[model samples]
Target: LIWAAIHRIESGLNDFESQDIIVGTLGLLFGLIIANLIGLAFARLPIIGAYGPIVFSIVFGYAGMSIAIRKKSEIIALAGNLRLGKSGKDHGSKHKDMEFSGKLLDTSAIIDGRIAEICSTGFLEGPLLVPVFVLEELQLIADSSDLLKRNKGRRGLDILKQMQEDNYIEVRIINDDFDDVQGVDSKLVRLGRKINAKVVTNDYNLNKVAALQGVAVLNINDLANALKPARIPGEHMNVLIVKAGKEENQGVAYLDDGTMIVVEDGQKYIGSTVPVTVTSVLQTSAGRMIFVKIANE
Candidate 1:
């Protein structure tokens, strides 16, 4: 019966991939070594010395094997590092050379379309991966009955095509998907975890969710906000008053890049272009606002 049970256990282990077995074996060996060292330290304890090593060996060996199986990738990476050290290669430099392992583009970011311009600037590095599911989502939007969503979806497709044509960057449409996962954002987070990549998105909720899951997110909106021209009081610029603001005699204009400018006592100039002096600039989490008045008013 004992021999039959042992054979069954061996057969069950065959279900695990080779890497898992190797990592588990290494962990068990490491645990045994640690247990032996601890046991030797307790050798002077007259009562505990006799049984301590055997108990520690069994407990720690099982614990280590379980942990190693669960964290096989980490153990593999650690082993790779040791190999690189022995070969005298600077493994740290390899990581430094990469801006990111990979960048997975989400639907919102693709629709926002600034990612194409950002990539064209040669600032973003590494492969840009667009999952098949994200493409399907875009197609769904393109086929939507709503005009706005259709246009946005088509625009995203165009941006993606442009990025693919750029020779300086690598854009890959990945087929890897998780049907078991529900939302696109959740699938994106899962894919990022699997590939150890960062998610590029313009979604606030996805950003928060990915952060909670310890996934890196490159928010395109945050990038745009960061890249906006910095303005201060006394700066003068031309703006066209597009509409009236909340305050009396206030006109609202927008910069070419969409920074809102509130003009003081200039409601009369609605629908007209005029020069305005920056009175103050308020930087908020939502966006940047410039308060201004007609120059020389």
Candidate 2:
């Protein structure tokens, strides 16, 4: 209205674009700017100015009330959603009762690095979850000063790339993060608990922590343990001892499965395949350690 009134006043003059007209236009614009600022200032005052405060309070108050009401309603809805009968927690509990086939791979598992071969073997079933934090850790390792760590990180990335390319494995980069958790291992445990998924890792400390939390963990070492070929005591096998063990006349040979075989009185059999009888097998948390004795050449 102010602009219209100003325009009307200007229109009454014949010379619209002359110096006099330009001066009037500038004066009107400056008046509008000053008036708007004054109106804003008056609107902020407790009980001053005409109409500005009352109008502003009514408009803003109604808007704020509507927003507050809506927020209250949303909070009620969310509370309802959190109930036992209708909660996401109940749904998750139901899922927990069922067999979860999915696996969450940790950064260490990927870097300790047998996952690619394990996946290639076609035995690792279900989707593989690589959390966003795990990826960040891998990237950090790839940027590390240690050559071994850098190589491991690059290898992990390469394995993921190959898995994606081959379509032999399913991959999901989960974006969930636990702000309260300080480390990726803890976040992984929380994620596994939340989703009722199994964690695949090769870290000994992580395995212990997961067990303590009662979360299911598929330790690569344990998998390797279960996958090792069963060797019975007194069973005969051929091995080539490469080095002497710490004990006297104890020769050490490694099997195809990376199982260390300790042979008694077989130091002369070093670098040569010789028949040996398995005397005993020690099954530890990590894997099997076979103690053998040379029975014949």
lDDT string for model 1 (1-297, tens) is 999999999999988767778888988998999999999999889879999999999999999888887666445445655565555565454643232356999999999888888888889985788888999999999999999999999999998998888756878776677879999999999877776679999888899899999889998877888889889899988889989999999999998889889999989999888999998988743578899989968
Lowest-sum lDDT 10-residue window in model 2: 69-78
Looking at model 1, the pairs that clash are: none
Q: What is the TM-score of each candidate against the true structure?
A: 0.61, 0.64
Give the per-residue lDDT digits (tens) of candidate 2, residues 86-196.
554646666324435668899988877688788878988967878888999999989989999899889888878787787778776655677889999999998787666
The lDDT values for all models are: 0.84, 0.76
True-vs-predicted CA distance for residue 261, candidate 1, Å: 0.5
Candidate 2, position 140, lDDT: 91
Number of the top lDDT candidate: 1
